[model samples]
Target: MGRLRRKLKKTLIETSETGLSLELRLIGQFIIFLVTIMLCISLILVATGVFKAGMKQNIALFEKELSHLSQDIYDDFGNLSLSSVSLA
Candidate 1:
């Protein structure tokens, strides 16, 4: 009867679980947060790479654009070697 009453008291307790288990749980959560931040940074770099590849144009496109702008400036200038930027 004493054993049964003790078991019942244990089941009805308000405070439970050990400190070691709680500390392990907190450490696991902190590690997850760090990993999540790393993954997010990696994703941002990947997105910027894709954005640059599509928007920066190719070597051929850049050269063709430069040739056109230089031709336009030459027609207007008397004999000046002025540099220009072609922004899109």
Candidate 2:
């Protein structure tokens, strides 16, 4: 009867240890998953920032070109008006 009790105690201990080990493994995996997700978020933020900067630069360039074109149009209109007055 004593040997049987000892055997039962050993089995219970082993079962509890197994349960603890499984829980720890699950926790570790969860931590790793969270870290991976954070890294992905950081990467996406960096990429978006770079994209926004590029878009701003492009918009500035476009505005500059539009201003130059508008200036040319205004000058042409002025010349046309002057020529018409001279003719009149």
Candidate 3:
């Protein structure tokens, strides 16, 4: 009877320990998952802001180039007009 009781007690203790270990592992996994989600969200927000800034810079450069081109065209036209008047 003594040996039987000891065996049962040992089995019970081991089973409880195994259950606790599994619970701890599940909790750790959940925490890791939450952290990963947060990191991804942070990265996306930062990337979007960077992209917007780059696009704005590009647009400003293009506008400046277009203005310069238009000015050049106007200057050419003015030169042509002056030359024709002199010829006449």
Q: lDDT tens digits, residues 1-88, model 1?
A: 9999999877656335333467778999999999999999989989889646755468779989999999988776733433333321
Minimal lDDT window, size 10, model 1? 79-88
Ranking by TM-score: 2, 3, 1
TM-score of 1: 0.35
List, residue by residue over 44-73, the lDDT tens digit for candidate 2.
Answer: 988888647688779999999999999999
| Whole-structure CA lDDT of model 3 | 0.92
Clashes of each: 0, 0, 0
CA-lDDT, candidates in order? 0.76, 0.92, 0.92
What TM-score against the true fold does each predicted structure earn? 0.35, 0.44, 0.43
Stronger candidate by TM-score (2 vs 3): 2
Task: List model 3 lDDT by residue over 1-88, tens digit each.
Answer: 9999999999989978876577788999999999999999989988889647688889999999999999999999999999999999
Q: How many residue pairs of model 2 clash at the backbone?
A: 0
